[model samples]
Target: MAQIDTIIASPSPVECRRLQNILEKEPDFRILAQARDLSQTYTATEALSPAIVLISQSFAALPEFEVMHMLFRVLDTRWLVIENGDACTPHLKITRNSDLFTIDLRSGGAGLVPLIRSVTRAQRRKMVPARPVRQSMPGQKKLVMIGASTGGVDALATLLSGFPTDCPPTMIVQHTRHSFGGSLIGLLDRQCAAHVMPAKDRMRLDPGTICIAAGGRAHMQLAISHAPQVRLVPSAPVSGHLPSVDAMFHSALRVAPRTVAVLLTGMGRDGARGMLELRQAGASTLAQDEASSVVYGMPKAAWENGGAQKRIPLVDMAAEILKAASMSGEEAKP
Candidate 1:
């Protein structure tokens, strides 16, 4: 098997040697060169172009996030950062249940290799094309808002499976990493009958179709132009997140008179405030019960904050949403 080439960039010689010794033991990893500064690291990277660049936070000089953006955009290099055992300086922040990804030098090199492999696989998976939404005619214009995070993928699959083929137009914001949005759309498309796709700016929300919030490049929002359309607006992270659940929920309030908001499993309180606003606007709202939620943070927050009017389980969530929109019955229930 081919070894994964790497460049170690650390300010301290001791740390560099330690990392080199540890990673060298792994047959799959091959250290090409070591650099003491960003300049040397950049030169070595341009020349060696290794698969992975392992750098220490201190040697990075600039802010960690700035360095990350610069490397990702300018060099297009896949790199991992070591925070020097500082829990406050997070190494990785992305989608999925775990908000942060870190590697502890104390644990030796055992966990390091596996985590890199997982990230590499995910990067590869992100390149796969998402299944396109099959075009269909518009249905009842009533809208449905869904917010989820953490173990939301499976829960969403179960709830969406119960959606009728002609279910109301739906907008979903599931906290996820950038490139992972396409993969999530493909996953849900397979598990459910709805025509699911990544929401594009100004894309109309037709009936029987589901628009999902994307990451990385743009954040998804709602607007009423020619029709209820998805808006991909460029904006900084809100509540520490792009395509924030609160953003969507607040927008739904503008159409609350004909909207049904559903809050699912997630971490944090991103959607709680929006749900509360929706409740105040006289919109029908549902939150997944704690027993059915993965983290129960967002839903629990909404329920406690008096934003959720009905607490439903994953199995019953779809039925409740459909019923609230007057789409329930033998023909509409899945």
Candidate 2:
């Protein structure tokens, strides 16, 4: 694992010292500097360029913090926000949330180390910024977006097994833990002909390769690029997920006419509204049939809300997805 350099910034001197002490105990973490105010935080960050920044919610609410945030984001610095006065942290927010996390300091500082580790791991995935979009491509491009949760591991293995080596660019958001993401990728790669890998920030989406966002500290979204790159942004959880299906689907709206969006077995309604928006934007959309889904929560919500154009069985899902993805940009629209 790469070393994680960090900056501890807080208006309170006590808070800064607290974080410095906690991080010092970790073998992987190195503190570049500690700041007593937002001003010093900016100076240290500009000089040291730390991998992560530990901050308080109070400083983040300040106007200057926003501008500094914008400047620092280009450097790939992820934030760990500390909030005071919470009875305790939310279970979902702390354990299974995005890289840019806010935890209740009132409970304890124990959550800080884990949050820092998650962000550090996420950074190693090459979270770069997206390049500017090109005007046109010689050949028409097609994209696929799939979302899954509960029982998704087996379901994804089965669905991906049917894809050809030359299949369209596909991005998937599957709910899991950050710690288990590498194993998930390895498992999917072994099961499928297409190259299955963790989604990198600004990675070019290409045919025959699949990028997955599962239990990462960031949200994976489609960004403007010649090949339509994946952009990973560290943010608060969306639809109760860090690497949320909703974020991915919503981000692809501009390319909806050339997209095929699918919702599969999941325990929540994360992709329902996003799928509906995609459908309305002329994308081809589908959901897994209840009988085929391990848990039918997400697909059911999508079907009920008129988000899915069809509900196909798991056995036929790969075939249907392939068909949609093979369509010409003009031919793919609803």
Candidate 3:
């Protein structure tokens, strides 16, 4: 068996020592580091990218804990939460998909050892690639631009579900914290037929690839190059968002005629003005109708303000997208 790298993060020195002692007994498990606070945990995780993090439940009380927690989920690390409370509590969650295991520290070595074994096994399985997948990115004259927020995650999953494996290059800006991008990519990748991944600076836009504009300090914009590429602009937040929807749509003004810009369910007016700009530039712009939207704020604004050419229901959105993208003629009106 290969050695598994693990970290212990806890506020209590006694708990840290206890975990250290337990981890040290297992030759196959290596204690890469120990963190006494949230700051150290974040730093160590980023630096080491450990296989497991034996984190205490108290660590959740630290400042900036929510931000760091979202960031940590992006990494391929299993969280073994050492809850000092009830082991038989109905709230205990130990699920493979969640990559989380909860155990009461009071239960002693019995619970911890079994959980470590289970987590390590799961980690090893995750490390093994089922198969290699390489998407052949061919440049298509057309592309799709999507801006969503609020209820964007489920909405995106539904929208991308209709995309074929070789659909046109698609880029999206979903209002989210910088650290939540990876988690979103992972969730969408599992549900979508097309290859989904985070957008990188200067990466070419090609068919069969879906670039998600999120994470980090920069906003994702279309590169001003001969061949269209993704450009990450390290600038201030626009429209109250770091990866603003308006920033992405405005960047594609030159190619708006060939782009299908859609504004989906969101709480704010971030993408409304940009969608209007694209519509005026001859892009096929559509906003999700109030009937299908969870909040109906962004799409409603777009439609009411004439930014979107039409108000489309979520169910009909996939078919409309396919029709619009495949049509060859004057801008296909939604």
lDDT string for model 2 (185-241, tens) is 755675567789999988998887799998799999999766689999999999999
lDDT by residue (40-111, candidate 1, tens digit) is: 776677677666778776644232233233333233456777657744422233212322244557666557
- Model 1 TM-score, all chains together: 0.58
Decide which is better by TM-score, 1 or 3: 3
Task: For candidate 2, give the lDDT of residue 180.
Answer: 56
Worst 10 residues of 2 by lDDT: 129-138
Cα error, residue 330 of model 2, in Å, equals 5.5
Query: What C-alpha lDDT does candidate 3 achieve relative to the native structure?
Result: 0.75
Specify the highest-TM-score model's number: 3
Sorted on lDDT, best first, the list reads 2, 3, 1
